[model samples]
Target: MTPTTGRRPLIGVSTYLEAGTRWGVWELPAALLPAGYPRLVQRAGGIAAMLPPDDPAHAAATVARLDGVVIAGGPDVDPSRYGAERDPRTGPPAEARDAWELALIEAALASGTPLLGICRGMQLLNVALGGTLVQHIDGHARTPGTFGHHTVKPVPGTRYEEAVPEETSVPTYHHQAVDRLGRGLLASAYATDGTVEAVELEDPGAGWVLGVQWHPEMGEDTRVMEALLLSARPAPLSPSGV
Candidate 1:
């Protein structure tokens, strides 16, 4: 479907705010998003926009204009957000990004905007919902810098299953995993070692929300992104309601 009732949705993908980035001759603080993130959105028929960390208070306003939102993968979320001590193995906190993205998640949920979270995005989703993290895990990202691969089996009848029904290998790269699921969220998929690889709304009527531990933008799977775009599409008016 072309989503004519709504036009192609404009999906905002969150980005990383890093210090001391250089390309040619200018080295300064930068808001960066991996090329893969925007490419995935474009490939799935949605216009991609890079959203850098801004005043947390502006998140609601930002989301109100976007058709959908994507929380991109990034550094470890500050443990303090979930009332936990920082694990030694956890990466240093990107406090600004954490605060900003959490606000975005809240805005998306409150406004019923379709949302998709990948990798670190998933971890933040858990924390945003009053859940905790394992902090450290093995095997999922065996190698340090490169992405590993893992097959995940979806829980039957879940939205994750609806999009990817069969067991499938995904580009995996993360050290922390969701431990206690957030309120109103359910583990929709698991890894071979029983890690929570994907999560979604328990009842799933509060707009579209999905978080995957894997990096979908790094691989060939368009199903996940496609589903988000689908949710952004509004049903045509029928005079009876609109």
Candidate 2:
């Protein structure tokens, strides 16, 4: 369903390109993302726009027009980004995507635009902020290419805790975890094994910035997305009703 009235906050969701995809009498590289990403944004009262990987030079200009940004989950980030050798468990590098999304992250942060990073997106955010990654972890994923359900507990009195007041089950599919806290970021939630499941900007004045190691778009919980929408909302009128 489309919004018939009012201004819907424009949300930019990063996407990947599947090279050499064939479909419906066309064969070419295809920019792609799971439909759930857009659907979730729309359901949360935002106008979702897919952002295909592009020249890093244009990232600032691209984000300037968006009210919010979401770095959707995908391939593992290149280990070289964090100054580590690639682990055998790490997926092949999608260097173009890395460059593009890293640029977007920087732009979003610099502009103070509300941003949400999911799975690999969360890792990328850390890398962009001078943090390192675990590279690989066992028992996080139940199987290859599949998601598992797990309970995540939020740190008390945090924005993440405010968004999710209680422990919640979330769909997770990742083998890497944050190994160090990013600059000006705090771990806001954790898994039973003490894996960092969620993080947010440490400074309350940094604007809205949150990252999750799980796929919220793939789950039924709308609170996380709702929080983003709240941040995207226009400020209310003054007491005199300006």
Candidate 3:
């Protein structure tokens, strides 16, 4: 696989904007992300930047500067996002995050910026593209406060399969999974229970867009991230354009 060349690609990962976070004897609204997200980016030859919930109007402009975007996994997507009623088991709405990340996903898709969505990120991606989700599922996240594992089998001839083209065990932790696929998005991988574990845009011209139900950041494999960094590089200037 090709590493990002010449300069380290700038990778922007969306973060959580919580109501109150306590650290050092003070509690305040904070924008934070799991350390693993940045570590994964750094390990894959890119510069990691944290993207806090910001004005939705600024999303397109913000994405214009980054080489790629990762909508980091977080809270359950508000059921209303895809015109769905809230399931009894659905987690309460994270309205701000939903709006912000949806804008970010739109911007990334519009700009054809390499985008990877993990867990909640993946769910929001589906919503952004006019798809619905399974609000709750079983056995995926059995133990509280701990990560689980499952094998994800990739579809033949998919970009995801090219990255890790086998039935591979992944570090899994999600209660929701993709139900109805989004427009032009293909189910790239699946769990043994037939859960959609991965989805990617069907059109290669749409740039690198992939969402994994499992969190690659929480695992040891770098192939998935490496694929993102590789796609982050800008294409060469042609004789006519240059």
RMSD of each: 3.3, 3.7, 3.3
Which prediction has more favorable TM-score, 2 or 3?
A: 3
Measured on C-alpha atoms, candidate 3 has an lDDT of 0.90
**Rank list by TM-score:** 3, 1, 2
TM of each candidate vs. truth: 0.94, 0.93, 0.95
Error of 3 at 70 (Å): 0.1
| Model 3 lDDT at residue 17 | 90
- Determine which window of 10 residues in candidate 2 has minimal summed lDDT: 1-10
Give all candidates' CA lDDT scores. Answer: 0.91, 0.90, 0.90
TM value for model 1 = 0.94
lDDT (tens digit, per residue) of candidate 3 on 13-117: 999999999999999999999999999999888889999999999999999999999999988998888888898988888888888899999999998899999
The Cα error of candidate 3 at residue 173, in Å, is 0.7
